[model samples]
Target: MDMATTTSTATHTSLASVTLEVADPEAARRFYGAFGVDTYIRLRASETHSTGFRGFTLALTVSGPATVDGFVAAAVDAGAAVLKPATKSLWGYGGVVQAPDGTIWKIATSAKKDTGPATREIDEVVLLLGVEDVKATKQFYVSRGLSVAKSFGGKYAEFTPGQSSPVKLALYKRHALAKDLGVPADGTGSHRIALGSTAGSFTDPDGFTWEAAAPPAPTPS
Candidate 1:
């Protein structure tokens, strides 16, 4: 990878959408629909060889414990496997679920308690990529025009999303991210996700691909 390449042209790059490669788009569609996150992602049918962790996770940030539980329960009822049951933690309450299509999702919130009845509103959708090195990957993205919104040394880094981007991007150490997601760190083959961005096409240091934005489909006259 060309670590020194300047992507000044990509200074305006922002994540436009995320597409998940799955074996069955219909099945994935149903699962995501039932899980209440269908509108947040796109899906394509793929039989690419992949096993274990897949090196990443999509997280949903909600309001409180009730909301966390609400989403987790919906995921479970929708045929998602529970990697971690909803529970209170030092930082907040959350749980992990693996969609039938093999995409892992973490639903969580900073508030430990619910202030009112649970609603299925998602506050944020974050695509967290597990990288070999946080600092190096951070610099790699910076060179590609992504601005750092937050950094925690070699542990984690988050980039500001372009105004129109729906998903927030972040980086985390592979092993640590796996641990947090309650899974093994070892994996191979494709990440099975493609990112649509305004920065043109390029692959990041971690093998995550970013492509130029697709023109919006025309409406019926």
Candidate 2:
């Protein structure tokens, strides 16, 4: 759900697109694109990453409570099912929605009360995976070039974003993740979120997918 960063020559993990497989790519784009930044919609499907999540959620950090409400209302209007209505949450004002594509979306603001219009409506997209072994999962990423900005024993861990990362990647212990989503921790198999890298295609300890991609082209001088 968060990250810890540092200087390292071999921090090989680059922040990549957290690709979601949907029946209709256009529809997914229209919906999620509004709530997330730099959302890349792919028509090509990955057999492994296409399976919907049994234990995960994508979170968007908004600027304030008012923006949180506004976005949730739009999601509900577009036929998303409300899992939790906008309200003051333990972590400030927040709400949840189940997208038509069967992905869980959460909108939250760090401020508890209305803070007016958001300067940036969609701040970040966090790929929160529910893992059976957080420590093992954390190590798997580290070996593949991910750097940890912060970690806690074996319950949770966060990865620092490499250049070009569009979304944040994180791991949480299974039951704890379930608690965060108000669901059961009895999920296994495909997580339906793909972490892409120029590094190549492979699967993580929890079976979440990551694909091969070239590093982003640098901006002109």
Steric clash pairs (candidate 1): none
Estimate the TM-score of every prediction. Answer: 0.92, 0.82
Alpha-carbon deviation at 102 in model 1, angstroms: 0.6
1-221: candidate 1 lDDT, tens digit per residue: 22322223445667788989999998888889889997778888899998899999999999999999999999999899999999999999999999998899999999998899999999999999999999899888888778778788788888888787778998999999999999999998999999987878999998998888775434338
Q: Output the number of the TM-score-best candidate.
A: 1
Q: Report the alpha-carbon TM-score of model 2 versus the true structure.
A: 0.82
lDDT of 1 at 112: 91
lDDT score for residue 38 of model 2: 31
Writing each residue's lDDT as its tens digit, candidate 2 over 1-221 gives 34334333457665576676666766776776554433432333434434334677878888888888787877887768888788886779888888877778888878887656555557777777888898788878788888777787777777776567666777888778667666556754566666678578888777777898644545438
RMSD in Å for model 2: 4.3
Backbone clashes counted, model 2: 3
